[model samples]
Target chain A: MEESLYREIEEIIEKYREEETPLLCVLQEVQEKFHYLPRNVLGYIAKKMNVPSSTVYGVATFYSFFETNPVGEYVIRVCKSTPCHVQGAFNVLQALKRELGLKEGETSKDGKFTLEVTSCLGVCGVAPAMMINDVTYGNLNDERVREILALYRR
Target chain B: MAKTLKEMEKAKEKANLVTIYLDGKEAKVPEGITILEACRMEGFHVPTLCYMEGLSSWGGCRICVVEVEGQPNLVASCVTPVREGMKIRLSSRAVREARKTNLELLLSNHPLDCQLCDRNGSCELQELAYEFGVREIRFGGERKTYAVDMSSPSVKRDANRCILCGRCVRTCREVQSVCAIDFANRGFDTFISPSLGLPLGESVCINCGQCILACPTGALSEVSHVEMVWDAIEDPGKFVVLQTAPAVRVSIGEPFGLPAGTVTTGKMVAAFRRLGFDRVFDTNFTADLTIIEEGHEFIGRVKKGGKLPLITSCSPGWIKFMEHFYPELMENVSTCKSPQQMFGAIAKTYYAQKMGIDPKDMVVVSIMPCTAKKFECQRDEMCASGYQDVDFSLTTREAARMLKEKGIRLEEMPEENFDDPLGISTGAAAVFGATGGVMEAALRSVYEISTGKTLEKLDFYQVRGLDGVKEASLEINGMEVNVAVAHGLGNARRLLDQVKAGNSKYHFIEIMACPGGCIGGGGQPIPTNLEIRMKRIAAIYEVDKNLPLRKSHENPAIKKLYEEFLGEPNGEKAHHLLHTHYMPRERI
Candidate 1:
């Protein structure tokens, strides 16, 4: 099953072989298709692209766009870098942690939500920002976090 | 002593101050400070190779170049001083390219010998090469070649792999004040060498071996005594024994993925036992022995009017500095060999006779955090027994690499105890890895001897710190004893100057060449800085404080060595085995 999964990832990667930014584009495509980039796919891409495994790991680790492990139905990413920090991002993170009942980098026991802190989303003027699933939520506050998290609950 | 506040205020007004931009934020820096200093104050780090604290900046390696908006080219921030309103960009494309090119140039000449190089994993040049994305060396040039100089007892110098960044020269001159090593010849043929191109041992070079720490590559390393040791072990006739320095326990863990300064004393012993050594000992045992010898020597000096303000000769780097810069004060140095060598000398003679093993057959391997002990073990005077005392000396870093190669994870192993007699130590021995540890250890013993009573409170809080120079005075036996301690060669020079000028009078003084005693020794690890050194020093002290015993005089193993082997601490046999003499260095 793992070998077959690698074969499918390779096919998806080869689909955009000629693109200049194949890594970024392919990574985006794979994430859009599977919700999270698989570790084996990144390893396979590193071998096929002739790049260092560390470099590929660094790229995957650096941007919050990629994930090497599985995520739950809803992945909540709170901006925690300097700009967001100045605009009460800690409160937003706390709100998410309280709402989802999960700490940063941890998934809820029910597999309904996963929470994380990211560097930035280039939305400093909007103050505290978060990305829930595929859509970005800006100008977030403690109450707004509650309202957004309420929409995701069963 | 101050006359008035107005006079002090006037003096403060003369201080130089300059302002500069760091990542767009402005920082005020003192006038004579580099632009990098200003940037660092604003929490911006400009990566550098040729810049070391307490050493003069030589803009040779372009690693720390930054762009000034009005300036045509990037300036090396480590050397270039900040001007008022000067705007600098630390993350510019041109600056990055220059650094990348510089690394490429260095790599082009550097031999692809990383696999076997002692500095392989911790090399700064290798790290920068990877960081700059150097896929290949574009330039093709004939690499320089010269015979590897292992003539010195302490260090080995391989000129082939030298980057000529002048770090060793700066460390030798500006920090150590030795000036034994200097850049020789013209560009393209430029290399670091002793005066008149003599081998290090033959020249005025002191066997301090601090250059081993300053060097970025395998150009300067401790001569490996491992081959001779492996032979002794393979012969099946020898009883191979190993002893490790105190700092080794704290810093060796880093190479095995354990955090730096994590105490792994028990695990270290377990690994040594697993390595097939017949007995695993602690250099702390002899560090305790050093305190007893050095303490008695101090009392003898005070009573017999031999020499006042006796400086420690334990650090090979400081010993070299005295040979070059303070040759007249060579008499002021303690005559005892460092704990590592002292342990080896005794193990071959006293311990050998006790264990019923032939001195020739016994292999004494010392695991030290010092590169200088590599030279110390090879000294002509070290062989008190019929055979050479220490067959091989491995740095803490090297030992860790060996463990990794053997697939022994320190974290996986359970904590174990050291072998019976030679492995026992006191808090005094354990603290020898931190700054001012020797002075504190000596006081613990000497103070007891002076008072004719045991000390309940062993901690000498006054001297136990990370400061460069620490001074204290104590009243013992109705007499005042003044002591001073300094770590790092640059700091040692400052303390030595006052004593030389008759401005200060210290009965006993301790100095370690590296920043924080053995914990900050040159052979320990890379990125050994103020913060890291402090952490390791704290770990050493923690090991000391947690130990059940805290005084050197109380160690049962040391007492057993005296009773069953050497007879006494400073006995004739002890002197023959452990003590060594120094010589006047020649003009550079």
Candidate 2:
């Protein structure tokens, strides 16, 4: 709850105050600004919008895109869909986990990388795909995953 | 929305009629009515699990599916609107098979521990299973078992028994406007949980227990204090005393096979005495005490400009709601403790000392028509008697169960009177069980005290009814005293929001957390719909009409207690024993 963070949340709420069904947009902007939705910020938005905190929390937890907890600077989400699994996505995921020394849904000790398994990332053409901080790395094997991890190490 | 039978009848007069076929019988019904309403009007009982009268239609269970002519699949009757000449087969073979299959699917994941469940006999799912002749499970699978949440003092949550009807969610969000619980996850992992998956005790739950009344299963129930009460009564060193609330006497007869709104005050007293309570008192005694203290505070505020529009603090649920949602208005709320807490405070101190009994050895138990009373009695501020004032609080339902467990039949018991001093009350106190009763009772006393004259007409009809909000104005000694009454937390929120916006123009306001007040409390009998609530309210007025003393200020015992012990209303000693303060709470 830094002063700057509070000011940013207040600005976001003011921007969407008059829009119909503004909860989703307000939450999306909040997540984008803070990297994850903080508890106090969510409570502040609920009070400003005159909506129940439980309703806001419900919408937040219902969708997978919204995160309530903090994540690493670079979040790596490995696709675990049918097409990706057929293309040996497990090996790619294992390689990433070993290289980063992080388990699934865990952030690294240095807060540099977060490893996660997600449903289809909508890039099935490039099977065994993974995304890190908006950059997609697809057609991956152990060597490619290791190379991908090394690129972000510095 | 699913309209009740009464609402449907009212709509039939104004709306155009549509002819529909039910089991090949032509029936004319309201144009915009649902198939379930048509079935009910035609005397065809279509079974349903998720469909309630006044709540929004959620068509989740699919148990009320009916075959419509020319439709490929059976449509849920609860959600489908009737059309001209639409043929509906309510209990046909296909419909019955679909319902049974739906029940089997629901049971596939539900634990079959009905015999040991708290709602075994009265469970809607259990009743439906019996009606559908579902003796054996056709499909077996891995059952979902969740750890029960017993964190809250008022309500318990067992997600394993929930049918995902969403009734409790709707009741909390739509009716009470306290959206503390909702569907958290997606698909099979979905379960009702508080905000951020916090335990209910730590959430913004007001503990009104309206959700329990809406739940068709035992997934949500009152946390019982029966074991503790039983232990207190059986202890040789304890002098266990009981106090029954005004609302409990009118509604307790429902669990004993009696119709709703039956006044069994005498029988309730007899049953408690037979169950080994040393004395059976009335919370109405302290309800009378509340009026004396609160009415005086109101007059003082008006005269001294202490605070205008003094709000009542009789309902703990309403108090908690005010704390979380309207914290700024907490200063306007009355400082008097609720009648139940006041009785506990007085019983453990005044009564214990007068009767030559040690306060430690005296256990004060209260029988209330509320779930919030369970939480209210345990509050840190309620221990005014140097100990926990009220040791345990039980609901009317729990009291009935205890009576039955002791083999005491309420109908067969001889009529008896309550113990002296703490048992006697006025007709105004008797009406405290219903919505608007507090305002009416206070008006009766306030008007007389201000004018120094008796009131010829006792009933204040303007403030009495099932309306969500009620307003009335009275001129007392050339000064207009405007007042408003609101029941149900949703209605209270509306009124409070108006007050917060500086739009309120009243001198007093009475707010009850439950719809129709304590008679329709969360701990009342099951099936406590609008119809039953009205009946219970009528019975409350009937009790009031028959009583000799109708004003709280005129109660002989209360007057005696004030004259003998407490010198004056809202005095130093009375404030220490009866009044309390409030604090703001986090919205999350």
> Per-model i-RMS in Å?
21.6, 1.1
lDDT of 1: 0.78
Stretches of candidate 1 off by over 4 Å are A1-154, B1-32, B320-327, B494-504
Q: Give candidate 1's error at residue B364 in angstroms.
A: 0.8
State the displacement of the C-alpha of residue B5, model 1, in Å, after optimal TM-score superposition: 29
CAPRI tier for the interface of model 2:
medium
Instruction: Name the runs in model 2 displaced over 4 angstroms.
Output: A73-154
Question: What are the lDDT figures for the candidates, one per model?
Answer: 0.78, 0.91
**Tens digits of per-residue lDDT for model 2, B42-116:** 899999999887789979999999999999999999999999999988888999999999999998888889987
Count of clashing pairs, candidate 2: 0
lDDT of 1 by residue, B400-442 (tens): 7667756888777789998877789999999888888888888
DockQ for every prediction shown: 0.01, 0.62
